[model samples]
Target: MAKDAVLVLGATGRIGRLLQLCPPEGLALRLQARRAQAAAGKPDAGWRLFDPLEDPAALARAATGAAAVLCLAGPVPGRGAGEMADHIRLGEAAVRAGAGAGARVLLASSAAVYGAGSGLLAEDAPLHPASAYGAAKAEMEARAAALGAELGVPVCSLRIGNTAGFDAILGGWRPGFSLDRFADGATPRRSYIGARSLAQVLGALLQRPALPPALNVAQPGTVEMAALLQAAGLPFAARPAPGTAIPEVALDVSRLQALLPVPLAPADAAQLAAEWAGLEPQLRQEQSRR
Candidate 1:
């Protein structure tokens, strides 16, 4: 059988690059970025230029004939107003394009939408976004969900947890980068997933006929920052940041596990950290230059 085509926005981003490297079997991928240069050397047939804010038509064109639309385009934290507006516009365009193309839409959301709170955060957890970035993501989720409903298209807002990337997780042990601690000076716990696991989960989501309105994508176990650092055999200091008190956020992945592949346990995260230790020297050099 011919493979279904899927459209991926932000095709050159961190997650996008991972999906490209390990795409789901039996799916043809169409990757969209702001410019062709952004996807240089990638397969030309699958690459296209699309600016959601400036060129909605182009985005729609990219979405045409796609079985699913994975919207991953958004501004990072601390971006200016124009960039934030663009991020909002991108979300709008994604739903419109996906609905028009008769494709399922998956919006990549963040765990920050749950705000600071202790205990397992389910998909229906109260949304009390603590920061502007979190608030923006919450708004995006709401808008996308509404638009998908209005257009009669299926949508899934995936609230992703702290993803342990090579640089962030391994390099976290170095000085100047401290982990968060509670009032008792104990390292806070969080649910985390590695990049490879995240990719597998996303691939599974794409194959589903229908999905829950929202789901928390995370690992099966909660990991303490101190334990993770210790397992990596690195010295680390924990300090409380000056801010309004917030509870440690832990995501409930029961729904995710039921639908997707089994996620890595907390011990697996520590093991992965140890495996990546050799890259710490290079990561530190890169961090110092930055």
Candidate 2:
């Protein structure tokens, strides 16, 4: 089997690190990070200090020669960076880079793109975002999808749900997401997938035969936020948003399962949520004082 070299954006993230672990056999892996100095000396690491807002051309150059580009870069909630403008810029950069490089791009989208709608969400569900964050995600998804068709590239977007696990990437101080919002009775029910499983899905995509651009990557199970906190031994209560209702953000993974060789399983979401809960207090304090 011919191997495909993959360029991973946001190479230092939780999912990005997992991409490094079991990359397709014989395919070279290149990493692009904001902080080249931080990524220096790491094996298979290629640092590109390209800001999403400033250097689209440089990003395209970095993405050149790659068979596939896995874009894990974007504004994350509570991270103080996933704001609407920033996310849009990131999406724009990704589209430009992927198109210029002529690489099959797999963009990391979010279930939040579906917004706070009722019923289980699917890839084609109506996007009615309730928050600026969700709106940005939806906009980015649309932008990437449109660019994929316009540029004549195989661009697929994965609407990921709550991804868990991995030590460093997602463990630090970032506020505004559900986990932190519902830390002590913040939000209600939600869905989650382990980072390992999320990585497995990405690996499966890398290995699968080329197809039309479209797919959702997520676990099957949907766990409530309160139960998740309890599982993690944290205070469990209802931390409802004032004007927002938390809708079920389930990414139907059946499409990917039908196409891929291996199936993804749901790990202990509650346990994973609990673990993050344990760190919430400390993280909150660190951020408050900052």
Candidate 3:
């Protein structure tokens, strides 16, 4: 099998780290981080200092000779106009770079683009973004798709689900964060994919000759918030907002399933909780430093 060189932007984030740790077989990686220091000691994989917004040439350079460009770059969480502008700029840079390189492009998007919904959300579902973050992602997807069409390059917007990771599970219990519930007192269910599964899906997508315009990436089943907390062995308190309806964001992953070599199982909340428990102390220590 030939090794396909893939350029990954925002290569220092949680998802990026997982990709590095468990990359797809026969895929060579070129990881671009904001700081050159972040790439230290990663000799097997190509590394470069890149700022998508400020260094457009660098972005193009990074994409050169790459089979695919995996864009994970975006503004840090903020609802301000400046943050939204930055998010849009980052997406534009990624699309232009990938198009210039004539490589396949995959933009990491969020399920929030589907807005508040109760049933299985498909890729073709109407986008009704409720938050600034979600709106930014929707804009990115639109722009990337248009660019791909104009440049004759394939682009895929992956509406990724909740990723099972330490911060995702434990952050709910952090102070000032409240777990949401429906007005009827039912915990909202959400589809999620483990880090390993996510890596596998990305690998398969990168290797494919043609790509779908959009695909919902998630596991087979959904998990409830209360069950997730219980599995983590944490005391739960309802912070139900009166008249606020929590939406169940379950994804229809049949399209992704058809592409994968094996079917993806629903995430094991109990097992994820157990893993989070083991890292609780470390997580807390890091939180304190922040």
> Which candidate number has the best lDDT?
3
Ranking by lDDT: 3, 1, 2
Residue 12 deviation, candidate 3, in Å?
1.0
Residue 233 lDDT, candidate 1, scale 0-100: 68
Report how far off residue 135 is in candidate 2 (Å).
1.0
Using all chains and alpha carbons, the TM-scores for the candidates as numbered come to: 0.87, 0.76, 0.88
- How would the candidate models be sorted by TM-score, starting from the highest? 3, 1, 2
Model 3, runs deviating above 4 Å: 166-172, 175-178, 274-290
lDDT value for model 2: 0.64
What is the C-alpha lDDT profile of model 3 across 1-290, one tens digit per residue? 77998999888776676677677888998998898667666555688787888888988988999989888877655568668766667766777888889888888888888888657788888999888888888998998788778877788888898875533544447544456677777776788776567788889888888878999988888878677777866676677655555557889999999988888876678865664555446535533442
Query: Of the pair 1 and 2, which is ahead by lDDT?
Result: 1
lDDT by residue (1-290, candidate 1, tens digit) is 99888899887676777676567787888888787666555555488886777888888888989999998888876787566655556777889998889999888888888888668789888898877777888888888888888999888888888766533444434566677677777676677776666777788888888899898988877667676667766677667845664536688888887886554465365655653454335434433442
Clashing pairs in 1: none
RMSD in Å for model 1: 3.6
Clash count for each candidate, listed in order shown:
0, 6, 0
> How displaced is residue 100 in candidate 1, in Å?
1.4
Model 2 C-alpha lDDT per residue in residues 1-290, reported as the tens digit of each score: 75676777777665665665545455667777776564655544555666655666777778888788878877656455345557666766677777788778777777777777777666677888766766777777778778777887777777777765332223432343234243345445556766545656677686554744557666666666545545644442234455455535566667766876766555465656654555446444433442
Q: What is the C-alpha RMSD of each candidate to the true structure, in Å?
A: 3.6, 5.8, 3.0
